[model samples]
Target chain A: MRLFRSTLTALALALPLAAPTLGLATSAHAAPYTIDNSHTSVLFKTTHLGVSPFWGRFNNVTGSFQYDAAKVDASKVQFEIDVNSVFTADKKRDDHLKSPDFFSAKQFPKITFESTSVKAGKAAGSLSVTGTLTVRGTKKTITVELAKTGEGKDPWGGERIGFEGSFVINRLDYGVSYMPEGLGKDVTIVVAVEGIKG
Target chain B: MDPILALAFGVVVPALVALAFVVVLRRPFARTARGGETDLPAPWAAGFGLAAAYGIGVGLLLGWPDLPPVDVTLVAPWAAGVAAFLGLIRDGRVRGAASGVLGLGLGVFMTGPIEDMTLRVGLIAGVTASMVALERGLARLSERLDPRGAALSQIVLVSGAALAVLFSDTASLAQATGGLAAGLGALFTLGLLWPRAAVLTRAAPAVAAILVTNLWGTTLFANGHPAVLAALTLAPLLVSFIPPLAASRRAILRIAVPAALIGIPIAAAGAFAGLRYFATEDASASEHATGPTDPTSPSAATPATPSGTPTTSGTPTTPGTSGYDPGYGY
Candidate 1:
């Protein structure tokens, strides 16, 4: 009778500790963060004809991220870019880019990216994120260098995080082969995004 | 700036210049067939100027990124201009639409617009045959149709096509329409301001046909629907069937009936095109995305401004793949 009572007491004591350990394991994996589009921007620069490079950006971008500082490999990120929000300062140039020649904003309204894998990058505290980027219905796997910018508490005490990265892509590879001779095939994209814990 | 702004100025400037030309030349050349020294109505000069304005002004806008390739729109107007010059030859008349056909054919051949030999030749032959046949039938009934009435009809039809082009985000093509509108407007203004000096020539429809068919080719080349151009061309010919009246009320009836015939269908086509464009535009879809900004849905990021207005950022390129030509297999 005493042996049975002692075993039950031991199991009851371990249950509280075990439950916390399981919860901690999940918390360590990653936390969901909503991308604050107002503070995020995507910039791209391309050679005009091997003579000069021009820069442009998408104004409206929204996405979410599953990120953990300790478990970087388990993180995932996704983004949706409003293709019609392409702005290059000059309205005429923006129109040309939005046209069927480059992005075909009407045919493909969104440029999207979803991460499939991530690993430690070359730089310290940086991650190499591999994702499928879809533009104009054509998708290709691209790797972007995602460096952790910072994390802190906002004025409202909400947790905020940020990332800054860049990568190069071929427009032709994305099926944007209009005036190939007039515009360089390769385009360089830069990204800076902030995430607010929801 | 909106492309409409550029297109508008492209027209206003040339129209002012053409008007000035008419006024300047009026003192020297204004005369009637009845042998009176009146202000001149230079149909040939006005027609040539009108064609030139649409050709050069709109061509520059359309060919910005297209490099040094010849386009049919670039040449067809000049051919019509040549036909208009024939109108100056003191009765060196081109029967019906023959002048326009010859001009467009020569224009297509000399320029060698597309690399595809079969397509280029086919367009040239088809447009020429269709246009010439239509104009010839109308020319046989020219006695009942007045020149002013015909000129007015051309303006109404071209304006309809222009509105449709504008809605399709085709700035350059829209500019071409703007130029044609300006030309016809110049002719009408001159007719109204100096009635005796107005030179409404018999060759106006044929000359105008070149512009219409060029637009027909352009719109079909860009967008598959050529009904706007087809409707534009057909309505004017319907005006020719208006009966000739020898009564005192002949002047108003002759002008009014033909205009009404041409204007109604053109209006219908323009309105339909506009409705269809707005229906399919991405902005409309975005507008309905008015629910809560769900963090789960990435599309919620779309800005409200683009949905409500004709944004400059989303306009398409000129002619795009519609102008794509694989080299001839010759």
Candidate 2:
């Protein structure tokens, strides 16, 4: 009976030590992280009249990500952006962006992204996330290079991970083609987000 | 293409194409109407030309729009097509009612999937009523006015609305509307050159449809002023009620009087739009006025998707994606 009890104690101690190894072995394993809305920003810029660069951002964005620093290839992220949340610091121009001529926010109210595949980059803590981006009811597959900013425990005892990514898309490809001359068709989208572990 | 060149391509080419179509089809269309082989009472050549021209212009500017159109802007060509088809119905009452239904559908489509039920219903109802009333008024005016007079009035009204919608801040929409005015101006010229062949009888439904749809589209979707839209809408109907002038027997007087009457409201709407535009510009001056926030401006530099080199080539390929030069690095 003593021998069996000793084995049980030994197994219990081994299990705790083996847990992290098991996690590392499973390449598909991931943890869900809710996007920290307060710390997230989705921004874009285009040229105006082919003369100067113009910038704007979406204010209301919500999404969650499945991430594992060890298994970045298995990571998946998705975002839902409220189209009406588009802001350019100018109300009239913003309104124009929301109109049918541009985003057509009324007809297609949300711009969404769902990562299809994630590949680790050559650099440490860097990844290339390939996803289908749907804007104004049109979908296009795009890849964004994401670099890990940091990961740590917050003061409130919560775990957080941050990422910054940038990608270029031709707005015309997604049918947001308005004012072809007045506004540049190619738009660069930069996304930075802090994700909280639940 | 340069912006000036592109603007010209979008405006002038479509107008010329439409004029060519009208000129080419005038003889055949007039014969068919006169023979009563076609159900339509008049040639409707200008209406058909306008619809075709607008479609071609949209194609040149935005690429041929997708089937089951993905945007409200894409719906304009289809709407113009429907208006042209409705112009074919022989019965006046049925045509007017169908125009109202078309307006209802347009309003619903323009408002899109918004959650505001009251606003949706109001837009649908307003568009329906206005289309019906405008169709009736245009039919009456078409009977009394000569072809030149009718075409002149339409050109003036549509051109004015195009300018006003431009003031409202949607350059594409204004450009599309400008194509319509250009076609009408072409039609007016055709009427002057070949009055008998370019008869505008039965063109009321199509003409009214184009006008109402564009005005409502501007007002409902593009934040255009309702009062301005209302004033423009009233202008066409008001022309129908103008009393026969003492010099109505004179050719120039006949066309000028109605065009002048239509001009009154258009001028008023334009004035209102101009004032509103300047006021907004002044109020938002701190926000950098009309243009997009310039990256090099004193304000924070916004991170943008860069398309390295600007291409005058029609294709919209970004740098790195295609062989185009990479724009500013992220």
Question: Top TM-score: which candidate number?
Answer: 2
**Which ten-residue region of model 1 chain A has the weakest summed lDDT?**
A88-97
Calculate each model's fnat, 2 decimals: 0.00, 0.33
Model 1 interface CAPRI class: incorrect
**Global Cα lDDT for candidate 2:** 0.74
DockQ of each: 0.02, 0.19
lDDT (C-alpha) at residue B71 in model 2: 71
Clashing residue pairs in candidate 1, if any?
A99-B316, B30-B39, B30-B40
Q: Which 10 successive residues of model 2 chain B have the least lDDT summed?
A: B316-325
- Give candidate 2's TM-score: 0.81
Residue A5 in candidate 1, Cα distance off native in Å: 97
**What residue pairs are clashing in model 2?**
A188-B305, B308-B326, B308-B327
Flag regions of model 1 displaced more than 4 Å. Answer: A1-198, B2-8, B25-38, B55-69, B72-80, B89-122, B133-143, B196-198, B202-210, B244-253, B282-330
Per-chain TM-score, chain A, candidate 1: 0.87
Candidate 1, residues B1-330: lDDT per residue as tens digits? 234655555677556645665555455554653358564545445555665556555444343322232333334555555555655654423544455556355536532535678776776665665465445433432345554555566566667767766655454456666776776677666666554323445445434555555555445433325676566556645655545521236666655566677678878878776765554443334423442222123332244454565333332222121111122121
Ten contiguous residues minimizing lDDT sum, candidate 2 chain A: A20-29
For model 2, the superposed segments whose C-alpha errors exceed 4 Å read A1-29, A49-52, B35-42, B245-247, B286-330
